[model samples]
Target: MNPCFFYLLPSLLLIGFAFQSFGEAYETKPLACVLVEEIGGGGSSIPRTIRQTPVELHLIDPLNLIPEAPITSSPETLHLHVTDPSGKLLSPRLSSCEVTYLLPQEVPLAWVRSLTEEKRSPRALGHPWYSLSVKDDASGNTVSAVLGPQGEEDDKLTVFLAVYSTSATLYARLGDPLYVPCGFWRGQQFRSAIEWRHRALGDGKVLYAYDGRLDRIEEIFPGYEMNFSTLQSQGNASLLVDKVAVSDHGTFLCTIYLPYIRAQRDMQLEVTALPTVTFLPNPLFARPNEEITLSCEASHFHPLEISVELLRRLPGDSQFSVLPGVSLSTHTLNKDGTFSLTASLSIIASPEHHGARYFCRVRHISVPEGVTRSNTLHVAGVAGLSLEDGMYLFAVALALYGSLTFLHRKFKLVIGIHESKKDE
Candidate 1:
């Protein structure tokens, strides 16, 4: 056998044994289980089911508490008895039951034998921790009971969180500044660490984390910033996100840490984009008897509730108004999940329509009220009149000239005849 193989074989055996022993030690051998129903009096007992503290079952004092058979008839009392693998029953003690005390401070439990003693105050048990007792039907003895470890939570500190807004959801347009607010309601001085993470992104990308005592900040994303200058002193750890983008939409978790305690709050971000509005064809012109069409397009806007309308400013009109009979039409959605709307206005060009101005008005939640106007169509007017009207005007002028010439000749003939009669 190789020398290296002999050395590695012993190490592998030790590793396997250690793992086997660890698994066996932590195996779920629940000593006591209870089925509790809500009796609904709100006074003392925990309403829902609470299990026995996972303390070592064998370590419990046999004189004070003993294992009994699983109690099926009595649902009011906690069932602490579990049958062994060998089918042997370890009898229960009537004087006491296994109990765990959960209190922020150490308070000695006062064991009572009966509920008829009106002098018993639950407050006497502890300020926050209370005791529940059940009577042994066979022995008529009362056993004081609780769940979890006694005084296990006395050294534990709690961290509380308070958000700045009732609704943690916020909406912002793309390329706009955004703020997500979070703060610690307690333990400012003991605040050891603070973190901001994108929960939707699986928390792999930590936005920011700050160490107060060391006064160091680690910004995971290059552009993201935390308001640690003023907010850190005030127990506020809000993030000021600039030029937010579509990829920034997600639930962000803010965590405040103090020693062994920590708390978190979630804030949701939604990013939307504004549309680009323009006329489809520019510098419009028309002739007499011609039809003119105008299309106003709003492109690349999210949330398809955009309003589009056609407007016209006639000659001598100061303001533009909604042009009647113009219908706004929408087309198929764009590939980027935005919307495009077009409003067309057709005009049968006449002499009266010359110099008339047209507008394409668009309104959306992303922008203020505005109109994009088209060029004034130079329709054929008096300067460039229609061929038929020009021919009619020419005919009327010719008749008037001929009538004037005829009247001059007739007056001359009458004057010549009068002069001849005078000569005779």
Candidate 2:
């Protein structure tokens, strides 16, 4: 034998063994089919039907998974796992499968299950089902499928998912623009009918409605607006209130309808108005040693709950302290669902209190930092004379004295009785 024959023989054997193993693994890989239902249209309504496509389970690329036809109805237990074209679960149950329900955005829908041979299917509820992912624990292979409503084989099927805003409650300032977000994700191709309704009182009222081609805005709902172009192009069915009012504070329902599917979402809107603050008796004046009441009023705020603090900074104090003997009045309800309140502070006026700064600090949900209105105390003298009055009296007396001195000088000059020429 040649010297190199031994090396060549080992290399050829290793290559043959690798190829045999690859062939065996490929042959054992599971094969399944995904069932998809789609609506056909060609200027006329086409009946809905299911189409089947075969796929190698382990060879699927999870990242670039394409959405198949929409599922028309919620999945039954028998339909929990992927099946072959004949509507049968893949045989030879290769270990347990981990199933995850998902939204259109690929977000897990708060429901997950493990499918064993005995417990392979479980019912899911709560949110409208959109997409599903099934993974084989043993093989680490995943397959995703989109779901919609199911209809009869010969009937048309409508596929829809009601997607609500993540935020359940929205706050808007009074007289400001208010946006109520809502939209829908559909598995099939169809025109959408959108309606925005508000329920604040007895019955719900429609603010805006669109029927594919034409839009109907309620005459009573002025300043309500929507962008039809955006809604058609992007499925953005949000409603815009040009100016939010007390009447606009309520629960808003956005409903989207397709041929055979209808879905809706509701959100709460709360309107907040900043209170108008004022100090009663604008020019605060008090007599020395007299008891006086200083009142601060905060009016036209929403949500009822309010906090009032009467703070006082004495004539020589650097920081204001919470004043004592302060009382808040009961809240008064207004016609438009706003509230008004008065906070009073009673104190004895004295010279020490003169020129002191008094602050009325109002706090509410609308104004987190709080609003403050201040007034300076002007205390009159004990003898019923204000500081300004005393200054006026002093000026008058000085003028009289100057006039008397001038007259006396003139009289002396006139009596100049030349009888005194004393040299000094």
Judged by TM-score, which candidate is best?
2
Q: Which ten residues in a row have the lowest lDDT in candidate 2?
A: 106-115
What is candidate 2's lDDT per residue for 117-207, written digit by digit as tens?
1332222222334333333445433333333323332111122343445355789988888878775555444544667789986777878
TM-scores for all candidates?
0.44, 0.54
lDDT of 2 at 295: 90
The whole-model lDDT of each prediction reads: 0.54, 0.61
Per-residue lDDT of 125 in model 1: 32
Q: Clashing residue pairs in candidate 2, if any?
A: 71-148, 72-149, 72-150, 73-149, 73-150
**After best superposition, candidate 1 residue 8: deviation in angstroms?**
86
- The alpha-carbon lDDT assigned to residue 150 of candidate 2 equals 34
Instruction: Single out the weakest 10-residue window by summed lDDT for candidate 1.
Output: 107-116
